[model samples]
Target: MTDIVLLGAGGHARSVLAALALSGDRVRGYLAPVASDRLLGIEHLGGDDVLDAFDPEDVAIVVALGSTSSTALRRTLHIDAVSRGFTIATVVHPRAFVDPSVVLPPGVQVLAGSIVNAGARIGEGALINSGAIVEHDSVVGAHAHIAPGAVLAGDVTIGEGAHIGLGSRIVQGVTVGSGGVVGAGAVVITDVPAQTTVVGVPARPIEDKRMRNDA
Candidate 1:
């Protein structure tokens, strides 16, 4: 079993720990100076700076930070760890249903109750949250997040760093662009542009409308 150094110590980090435990990967400890000193009785291993202490070959790293809209921080951490000769580990919860034909990239995390169907390709550092569904032939881009209970029908494509909000539904063939955010419970039938936020029954852009008082 490979030893791991987990980054982050938030709720997502806890989830990652559970998933890692369920998958039987040994965790050395977690980093993140701002977080609590211990999680589930596991002692803190200092901050990101501590990565320098461990030989990269001896400890594989995994980031447990969940993306919201921007993947900048998560991406930066992953890349930095790799550049320093640390291996980025992949963790899939035993409860996740990933098809035999599906391919998941390094640093990917598939939490409990997630379903990734055949022919689906999950990109690097992507997080498929609990109870999320990625139907046949769907593509999840790097660092993108399918929030809890979100559903993506067959052939759907989610771009990099995009966030499909909790319980949102995406119809087949729809593409959510990079950095796009679909709000909770939105039903998306049309393509969502990059860096935009959409919400509502059929999903429309939440334009920043400035209301002005009469002059």
Candidate 2:
């Protein structure tokens, strides 16, 4: 069993801990900015600085951060850990069904009840959330998040750092461009542009009022 150090203490971290429990991996502790009541039983190992005490080769790190609007923080944490010589753990819930042909890169998280079909390629640091489905030949890019219950049909390509929101569905052969955001419950039929946000049925890009206001 691997001695794992989970990073983060948010709600998503709790889920990761549960999955780790089911997998029977020994969790040394968790690191976070502050202690969280949600993770009461787990030992809080202070912040990121505490990582310096452990030899990278002795324990693997699991990035338990989850993103909805952006994956920037999660990506940064993963990269920083790797830079420090810590190996990223590829976590797959025992209840999830991942085909033999699928390749899960380091730092990838396949949560409970998810299904990754044959020939699927999951990139580094990607999150395949609970009950999500990645059909045959699908390609999920680095740091992408396939939210809970979302479905990507066969041959779909999700670009780097993209966010496919909760319960969304992407049809076959469609590509969600890098850094694109597909809103919750959206049905994407056409290709999404890079750094864009699309919503509603037959997903369409909407002017980001927040971005405009910030300008």
Candidate 3:
């Protein structure tokens, strides 16, 4: 069993810990700015600086950070850890169903109740949160997040760093571009442009009120 260090200590970290427990992996400890009361009984290894004490080759890291709006911080943490020679741990909850043909790269997290179907390719550091459904042939990009209950129909392509909000549904063959944000419960039927935020049924781009005011 590999020694694992979690990078964050919040709700997401707790969830990851639960999954790790089922896998019977050795959890060395967790790192955070301060100790979390919720993580009682688990060793709190101080902040990011504590990573220096452990040789990267002997320890792997799981980014246990959750994101609602952006994946920048999570991506940065993954990159930094790899640069320091630490390997990222791929986590799949025991309750999650990942098809045999699905290719999960390093640092991917498939939480409880998630279903990744046949031919799906999950990129590095991507998150498939609880109850999310990634259908056949879907491509989830690096550091992207498929929030809880989000459903990506067959052949849906999620770009790098995109966030598919909770309960959102992407129609078959739809492509969500890089850095895009799909608001909760939105039903996407068209291609979402890169760096755009879309909301509402039949998801459309959010009009920036600040841009309108400036104009």
Candidate 4:
């Protein structure tokens, strides 16, 4: 088992820890700026400023911070961790099936039983929840979330920061614009405009903008 360090101790961090535990990896500790509380029986080691206090060569890190609208903050954390000489481990559940030809960038997490088919390109920080199926030649943009049990067929394009709700079914070759939201159990058969929110079978616009202003 690989000994790992988590960068945050919030709810999302806990979920990542649970996933790691499920995968039988060892979590050495966590580093956070505040909230010194223990997480999942693990101790809070210290803050980001205490990076120099630990031996960087011994710890591989996973930046387990949850989704935030601020791209700058996420980039800063990734850059700083890389500069600190820590190997940033990509956390994928053991049960997730990723094809050999699929390209998954750093910080991507595929939960249990998720199937990423051939030629799919999943960008950095994307989350593929349990049982989601990303079909062949699909392109999932950076920071996109395919919720549990969602089915995205072949050649689909999911734009940056978009969220495809649980059990949603997206047909082949459809494009979901940047920051779009497809509601739970939706059947998306057509292209979604950027920053829009769509729901129901044969998804129609609920919110005009594809990106949520406060997301």
Candidate 1 CA-lDDT value: 0.88
Model 1, 47-70: lDDT tens digits are 998789999878999998886555
Reference-based lDDT, residue 79, model 2: 96
lDDT per residue as tens, model 3, 1-215: 67999999999999999999998998998999999986788899999987878898789999999898688899999999998999999999999999999878999999999999999999999999999999999999999999999999999999999999999999999999998899999999999998888999989999645335648
Clashes of each: 0, 0, 0, 6
lDDT of 4 by residue, 1-215 (tens): 55788888887687678789988889888889776454857877889888767666777788777542233354467668878776777888888899999877877888778999999999887778778999999999887888888999999999987888889999999999887888889999999987778899988888544234556
lDDT of 3 at 155: 99
* Ten residues in sequence with the least summed lDDT for candidate 1: 206-215
How big is the positional error of residue 126 in model 4, measured in Å on the Cα after superposition? 1.0
Residue 164 local lDDT, model 3: 96
Instruction: Give stretches of model 1 more than 4 Å off.
Output: 35-38, 208-215
lDDT of each: 0.88, 0.94, 0.93, 0.81
Residue 96 shift from truth in candidate 3, angstroms? 0.4
**Which scores greater on TM-score, model 2 or model 4?**
2
The runs of at least 3 residues in candidate 4 whose Cα sits more than 4 Å from the true structure, single-residue gaps closed, are 10-12, 32-38, 46-56, 65-87, 208-215
lDDT of 3 at 96: 99
> Whose TM-score is greatest here?
2
Candidate 2 to native Cα RMSD, angstroms: 1.3
